[model samples]
Target: MRIYLVTPRNPESFWTYDRILPSLGKRCIFPNLSMPTVAGMTPRDHEIVLCDENVEEIDFDVEADIIGVTGYIVHKPRMLEIIAEFRRRGRFVVVGGPYASLCPEDLRGTCNVLFVDEAEETWPQFLADFARGAPQAEYRPAEKPDLTTSPTPRFDLLKVDQYHAMTIQFARGCPFNCEFCDIIVVYGRRPRVKGVPQVMAEIEECHRLGATQVFLVDDNFIGNKKLAKELLRTIATWSEAHGHPMYFNTEVSLNVAQDDELLELLRAARFTTIFIGIESPRKASLQETKKTQNMRGNLVDNVRKIQSYGIQVQAGMIVGFDADDESIFEEQLRFIQDARIPVSMTGMLQAMPKTPLHERMAKEGRLIAESVGDQFVFSNILPKAMSRIELYKGYRKLIAELYEFRNFRTRTLEFILNRGRQVGEGLAIRREELRLAARVLRDTVLSTSPRRAWFTLSLLGATLMKRPAAIADALAFAIVHKALYEYMQSLDHHLERVIGEIEAATETMTAAAVNA
Candidate 1:
């Protein structure tokens, strides 16, 4: 049977930066790794075509026996649309990935089949059954498959020119169980890592395809320290021998700061940045959320320690825990600013379906009376102590303060001065830094608006004259923030629409109750 794997397009959100990214000559940051992975899992006899709507237009008229759509919670609406479009054409549509895996009921009417959980164990069987003209309504893996057997994803199917980086996964799952996180629920707590040779082979494939930067799309890359160290050591040797063609990035727990050898290995492997989930600064909040691993040391100091190894930190922070009150937003912002974390991906707490937090909320009668799709569109649930409006206002204020040019520039400079001293190790590295600085300077000085040009120049002058070491760091921060600011503006508009819809729904419910 012919198969077309689909990744649906995301409606631009407050956090979308596509519009302003042209100024920096960057496209979207990361490509879809899941759909391609599913494509890789298909048996050799079956013909497979992959289309990521983010990079390609969907051809509804394209003839295929089966359509496979995969996405996460945020992309549910688009996934539903894709399924409906295919089903309307009398084609069999399979829905899977995090959203469908967590709650298959939401996809019942739209999808002819639901392949939940990891695809490796179930996908081959699903294809075999479909080829026999017997497609089941649902398919799930009986057990998690070993990562070593997973194929190098079908990167050939991607439009490499349309993205800033290609993604590869070395590992799955996390060791720590943060309450709000869905990683453990989805992949389990015992970390599973691909063998070093398997990972290196994938990297070699990406290199052969001219991918200069690869994101290791692991929830916690170093969660298994011994295995991770082994892989990094091999990667370091391979990268050095091959002229270090690719720079790596991945997410990890903050405990990475405790291991000096691991940090050295990561730097040697050309790993430049890490996304750490430093959820909150308040120790009580951390404990409340069961993120006790982060409470092991001074939070800011741990972050600085990682930065000392020349790895930039892009952290995730959330407000609205049971222990949190109104002051949480300001405190969170101050902590982020004080740490000089350039990319602070702050969001209101979301009790995702099937998460421990969600179960507890449902038990306590705190789960918002709305569908999972609605929650994805807006911050639907609220903390027990705070009103919904207060939470929304607080989120807005925090984002506004964090992205303001003056505050962003100041914090970035401070972070650079603190971390830049550790990065001046060799001539080659220095040359790369200078090249990036030059490009950033050109982009900033030649901005579209005169006011933007003046602001960019002023910020550039401040970094170069006041703290020369900070120029590279400041440039990186500016590129990310410029895109983030544009995305946040879009998000604000989305939030307003979501609020209006919620109000209308509430009014309709009230009127129906009165009539009854």
Candidate 2:
């Protein structure tokens, strides 16, 4: 039997980083680890082929008995479209992932089989039933599986060199209930962790496959602090034994800063970056969202302490919440700049399906529409403090200002200068990567514009002069931010057109209502 796994590509988003990948001569930011993992779970006798639509085009003509597809918010429409084509070609379609787990009804009729929630338990069961010429239309696990039983993701199945980094997951859940987040809703709040040996073996597989940079794709890596430390210690030992080949990064709540020893372990384990979801600094907003972990400490101080350990922070912030006002946007911008978070993402509040925020908004009759995919897009929920129009406008302004050249440069410089940088012993930066990074920076300066060129040259040249060892990593940062700045410009242009079209349609509706 031939099983084809498809990862629907995100056309335009910060996550894919497709716009930035070309300059670095890499195929994609990271391979969709979910597809490969699911492929691994299937019996080895079956011929499993994985295609990431972001990196390569989907071969709709490919022959396969079963087609397994997965994706998140951005991939919903694309998945539906792809499923239709498969069904027409007389193929069986199975749909599952974060989007399907929460919004199963969306694909009810489209999929021949639906596997909601964790597939670790349900996948094998479905395969057995199908082999016997009998399969359920839908199969959801009665409870989250013990993550320890999870199989190693099929890293060997991937085209290793195409990706700049490989990804693996160490844990399954987050302890805190952030109202808008869907992680807890899908994988319970108890934080089911993988055993230390399991995680170490996965990393070793990545290392063996030539993956130097590995991302721990857990929503919050330290949800179970004790388990996290154990994993880190094992990772440090394995990385050392393997000659310090694998560097790691992941997301953690702000509370990770409180544990000084944990931070040391992460650095010793060769973690160069961490993404903190410091939603908002406003006490009222944090309280409203139930992100209680962030409220415990001075947000700015926590960020600084974490960065001081040589693990630079890439923060995630939100602008649309019940307590948010017009002032919130500027506050977010100011806080990010002050905190020296060089790479921060600001998203409008979106009440994802079945999340606490979604339920509350639906009860209040504030949810005007249900079409939400892109994080940068407006929420279906209407804000109590502001209009939908105001929310979109503020979000656009915030993103634009945050990525503005001068502000971006200032933030980057501040972050690099103050960052508690990890020792270079574990880093395996290749000479070719350095040269490609240099070309991207050089072109951005000489070709982008005189002002941009000057800023790029001056800022990077100074950093290289002071910290020559930072040249490769700094160049990688430069490549990312430059793409981000350009992507922001494109978003601005797209949003203006969309808003204009919306206004025109609204006026037409009003005119029609008056005539009626």
Candidate 3:
């Protein structure tokens, strides 16, 4: 039987890196690890093929007995359309991934089969039952499978060159219970990690397949701190033995700052960047969200400490908490600028399905809409201290000011100045790096945005003069700035439409109430 595992096209957003892909000569930021991972779970006898719609179009006409569809909440509409098209043609469709796991109700009655949460067990079971012609309509695993027993993702099936990086997961679930986070709900709070040999083999496989940069795609890389440190040590040794063929990036909680040895190990393991959830700068907001990990010490200092280990700290920031008022926007702007985080992914607070935030918002009758998974677009939860319109306007202004050239330039330079010592002589420069440098130089020189070009050049200069080792990272940051700036410009128009819809809904509800 022929099987097609498909990842729906990602909507254009900051994470998509749509604006910078052309210059970088990549189709998408990276392949969805879930698609390849699900492929690995399929029986080897089946003719399995992986298609990430971001890199290639899905051919509905392809001869396949079963089609598996997966995506985040943002890709819900596309996933539904894909399933509908395939089902209309009489092909069996199976749906799963974050969206399916978090909100199975949304996908019920749509797909022929739905597998919710951790396909490690249920996927193979379904395939076996299907072969015997007695497959079930849904497979919801009651237990999260052991990561050590999980099969290596089918990275060989991916068009590795089409993506900016290859991805692997060393662990599942985060230890923290951030109220707004859906990871804990789906994967649970107890972090399950893969064995060292398994993780190393996967990295070796990615390296063998010519992946220069590997994103460790763990929700929180240090969730299991002891195992994480052990894994990092082995990775460091392996990288040294292999001439450090690939660098890594992953997300971690802010408490990673407290572990000096862990930071060193990460550097030794060739981790160039680690995204942290510095969700909000306000202490009250942090306490409200149960992100006590971040409130342990000075937030800015923690960010700096991680950066000092030569790992660039990218951040996930949120706004529109109940504790936030109109003044929160400027506060966010000032915090980001002061923190000197070049690429702060600032978005409005989202009440994701199955999360504590969602439950609280629903009980309080404040949930205005289902989460679209793109927080930058809008929030689903209504704010308590201000009108929804005020929240929208403030969010728009915050994003705009945060990405302004002057502020971005200041942060980039400050980061360059304060970042910690280099780990090893950086990885051997490749031809692609040379080509990307040339493209950046040419494009910036001929660019319409003089301020942006100057920002790029100034950063390039700073890295070269102070931290020559970080020259590649400097170029990457410049590209990120361009992507964020252009995306935010488009986002402004989208937000206006959302604002109109909210107003119309409010007016209709108010009118109905008056009639009643």
Candidate 4:
């Protein structure tokens, strides 16, 4: 049977960086790593082809016996559109991924079956049943599969030149039970990790494909400390032998600061960047969300300690928690600036389906809608401590202040002042990386001449003089900062109008009710 895999297009998310894609000449950061991976699990006899809609237009006219599609909550509408179109054409549609696994109701009748959960076992079973002419309407696995048995992802299916970084996964699940996160809910909190050889094989595959940067897209890279350290040791040895071509990065909890050996292992592994979820500075909010790991001790000191080890920390922050008050906006801004995090992706907290936060909001009758995955959009639940308007207003103020050109530059300067670690050896500046940094520098120069040009020039000179090898990454980080700033600016402008509309509509309803 002909099998065609489809990844839905990413919407205008705060992190989408659609505006900056042209600057880098890339279609997307990377094609959804899941589609190509699930494609690998399909039986070898069937003709398998995959298309990431972010890269190319989907050809609805293309003939296929079965069409496979994947998406998260944000891509629900697009996935439904694809399923409808394919079903109209008399082709069976199979839907899976995070969205389908957590919220199958979103596409109940649009497809023949909603394939929920991991595809490793389900895909082969579905193919066999299809071959026998008795396919089920849903494929839900009772247990997660062993990562060691997973196939090498079909990276060849991707257009390698179009992405900034190739994505790979070495592990699944997070050990922590943060109430707001769906990771532990979807995959258990035990943190199932791939064997060292399996991870090395995947990285080798990435190297073979000419990928210079690899993102180990684990929710928590250090979730399973023992295995993670073992993997890191293997990566360190293999990367050195391979001339350390691929600069790796991933997400891990803030408690990574507590482990000196793990930090050294990560540094030795040449992990250039890591995203830490410092959700909120409010201790009450952290406690409320059960993110005790972030509140273990002094948060700022933890961030500084991690940075001292040389891994660039990209913090994931959120506002609008039930325990948050008006003070939260300024507190978040102050913490971000103080922490010297060059890239802090702060957004309104949304109650995701199947997460504890969602269930709590539902129980309290505060859930207004399911989170559509829009970071800039309104929260899906009613704020317990503040009005929705107040939350939106404060959120707008927080991001606008934090991401402004002057504020962002000030934070970068602070990073330079306290910058302790140097880039790991053998991670050479590739032509592609340099070109992106150059383009970003040019853009910054064009927009920055009127103010702070001299300061930036001097800073760049110092950074280069002090850490020339790290300059490329520093500039690349500037590119991301620029994207986030631009996104925040646009989000502020649009959200203001949306807030006004919401208030006006509310006023109209109030007036109508009083008249009645």
Task: Name the candidate that leads on lDDT.
Answer: 3
- Residues 1-516, candidate 1, lDDT per residue (tens digit)? 688989887656433457644544445656779988887887767788988787678888888988889988778888887888888888878888988887778888777888789989888888778778887888888888898899878888777766777899989999898888888888999999889988888889888877778999899998899999999999888887877677888988899988999988888887888999998999989999999989998998898888888788888888778878888988998898888887888887888777888888888888875334333245546586676756776777788788877777777766766663432233255454466566666666664457556657666677778776556556666666666766777667766676666567768988999999
| Candidate 2: tens digits of C-alpha lDDT, residues 1-516 | 899999997777877676767776778878877888898798899999998886789999999889999988778889889999999898899999988988998889898999899898899999999999999999999988998888899999888888889999988889898998888998989998999988888888888888778999999999999999999988888777767766789999899989999999999898989999998989899999998889887888889898889888999898778899989998999999999898887887888888888888889998777746677755677787876667777888889999987898888887777777685542666776567866787667666888777777767887878776666555666677788888888888877776676678778989999999
lDDT values of the candidates?
A: 0.78, 0.84, 0.88, 0.83
Clashes per candidate, residues 3 or more apart or on different chains: 3, 3, 1, 0
For residues 244-287, what per-residue lDDT tens digits would candidate 4 score against the true structure? Answer: 77788999999999999999888888896899999999999999
Q: Which ten residues in a row have the lowest lDDT in candidate 4?
A: 449-458
Tens digits of per-residue lDDT, candidate 3, 220-281, equal 99999999999999999998888777779999989999999999999999897899989999
The C-alpha local distance difference test score for the whole of candidate 3 amounts to: 0.88
lDDT of 1 at 334: 87
TM-score of each: 0.90, 0.95, 0.96, 0.95
Candidate 1, residue 278: lDDT: 94
Ordered from best to worst lDDT, the candidate numbers read: 3, 2, 4, 1
Off by over 4 Å in 4: 423-428, 446-459, 465-469, 512-516
Candidate no. 4 TM-score: 0.95
Off by over 4 Å in 3: 426-428, 500-516
